[model samples]
Target: MLKKYILFFALIYILTGCGTDYMLSSFYLRKDFTWPTSPSEQKSLNYYKHVDGDLTKFNGYTSPSILATPANYLLVIYEIRDIPIYTKVYGVDGSSDMGVYVAISKNAETFSATPIRVGGIADDYGSPVSFVKGNRVVVLATGGIGFGNGKADEITKISVSISTNNGYNWTAWTNVIDTNIFKPLLAKANRFYTNPGNGTVLVNGTLVCMIDYKANGADTTPAGAAIIYSTDNGITWQLGSTLTYSGHRWARVIAERTDGKLLIAAVPNTTRNVDNIYNSNGALAWYMADSLNGNISSFQPSGLPNNSGGSIAGDRIQYSENGRSKSGILLLHSTPNRDYKNPGAGGATGKVKNAMSMSISSDEGQTWTLITNAIGQQEPYDKTSFRQSMKVLKDGSIVTCIEEGDKNVINDTSNQPFFIVYKRMGLSALSDGKYSYEGL
Candidate 1:
């Protein structure tokens, strides 16, 4: 009877709040958690694992994403040379491409960048996200979708490469989605949008991937975060139905919850672009899909930036905890500040660009309680940090990899960087201000 009562109370404590420290009323507010006191304390909250802290013009790391391997390894795929899309490359006026690099770490503490080139065309192929089934490791990347004229040839086909011997070597190019699949879809559409930052997940014995495109011939017709999935080890794929959402802006991240539901997050602001980093409307809108091929729920606001109402900071990360006793979903996202024009009213309002935070959901993703200050205060109002990836180790320790760049004060605005940084901490460490990093 005593044991039963104890378990009941513990359940209540967890449901009421992840202990009393994370007690939140709206899940969109970041008022309760303990924040870092000083710059030193904030530094303690986020330290580095791998990075030289150099800042060059187009040389620093930009979009960093991660995946877990079969043998408990963290496979990180990010763009080297760290150049942005649709820029000059190799002295060409309109040539821009980045080399895709993969790093494998067995313990998530130490990492080594492999020499193998994950899928990439000479034109543009970066941002490779991985998925594993048994011993097979499949890497899915882009062929560079062009904009600002008629330069959308790369978006015609979805390129893929597979490896059975871990992160050693990759196979040749395999077009998962041929030109017939996407070319016809985009032929009629006047304004089309597609970025290389795609996401994938194995759902109900089928591998599902998210690709956003709108071919309604007008911007008025809401663009959809469409789906393309493979069931046979990525050897063959099908162009599934379009999953609709709130405001289909930029690339999205898809994560499966512990309850077997999938949440796809996208940038909801269509009027804004990269030129103006942070404007008035800056937040991530999410939609829950029963299946990638099934009907998607209506669009709604997410609890990402907390009360700060910050912009969609970077690529949002989602992970349902490992093991049989799956608790809930852990969503790691970022934002610059609540109100960029006017400072500090609510929604994590401050001048902290690329500022990171987390939202925990127990009942799938129906509601989220924001845990503010996971890696907070990147800078005073500039871009402190952006584009991060996380790995939930077998031992329940979640470690995140971050980029410290020109905006983050890694180096001055002159030199770029090739290295990214990782910090060692769990969810509780975010509120406690435990900023210390060890292990390369």
Candidate 2:
């Protein structure tokens, strides 16, 4: 039995070497490597004040627009205070409610104190953002059940709230896109993509909203996740085609490049149970997809990089499945360690470390090359994880935020709910290397 088991393992390794390793090496290779300097040497800014409620916690803080401008500024929005966990069982009776608050930061680090409240909305969860375009500042939020009932079907709605006086005062909330319109046929069996998360961007003077929607049948199956665009500045929207893949996927961020192409990154939460048991034995993977002129190409290198040559551009173009001549889709996502059997468990047991992994595509979305895994230690829980928010600074330095400290649970007299127990991180120390920011 022992010999047979060894033989089986050897056979598996051989197959993986010929399959996974070959494909990965063809696309992904470590670039000029660097590491974060000492913690003290790292530059970062954190904003947290003890509000009236000891349970006041913020999650999903995002910028309204990826391309930052002085006149447009940056708008950060989040939910303040806590909700009862029991509300998940008893339903939203209005006894417990979460409020939405907004803060403007000119320098991305220092923020204004006066947080304006946007009324008529309930449970503004996930990454809610506000951006300025011409005369209007558009605020988009992910809608959750007003009460914490877990069963409530939350609709991903786009709310248009305009602010003329630099976000000082805002108009009433108006629903732009309803999730019901994009609901999949298998609604009950697959409901994860029911709500939207993260930030929104205005690409080429058109409003583009990216969201994660559920695909019915299996948990490991890929759902209907896509980017919806509105040419008339959020007045009307047209949904693009859904992505083609099988896994637990959610759209997180969108950015427009200098050449007027669209770049989108998504976090695919694939677990062992979902992968081995449900997803036909496929490993969990995070993906980045791109689209040129509303048509998605292959994945390419995201953000800026050193020595970005014709290879990066050409490979992404070649692998693009959408029949477009765009570059590759750059993928930056967190993956679990090998020792762990599942994603969530690995994350809990320090077996799932948050890593900043990258891939470059020259031919478009069809093929890709893996770049270096830059951030975090190899061991889980040993290195810090980059929060979903990432921005390219003026100095050409890549800036990403990490949640600092341990996880904590907040408790009221009657209920206890899990709240993110950490502070926001600013800039981190860059590893020793020659850095440049010519275009930025």
Query: For model 1, how does the per-residue alpha-carbon lDDT over 1-440 read when each residue is reduced to its tens digit?
Result: 99999999988888676655455443523321221133333333333366323444443354556655666655666656444421221111123545566677655555774434675345555545456667777766644342222343434335677877666677775766565655545564322332333245544656665655544221333355566678887778676556555544443544665556566666544332332332223556676777656777754644555211121222223223332233445566664443332234343433544456665665666666676543532333334554565654333345566554444332223443434666544443553532221111
How does model 2 score by TM-score? 0.53
Query: lDDT value for candidate 1?
Result: 0.49
Give each model's whole-structure lDDT. 0.49, 0.38
Worst 10 residues of 2 by lDDT: 308-317
For model 2, residues 108-159, the per-residue Cα lDDT tens digits are 4345666677545544433344444576665665444322224444433445
Backbone clash count for every predicted candidate, in the order shown: 13, 39
True-structure lDDT of candidate 2: 0.38
Error of 2 at 66 (Å): 7.8
- lDDT, candidate 2, at 348: 52
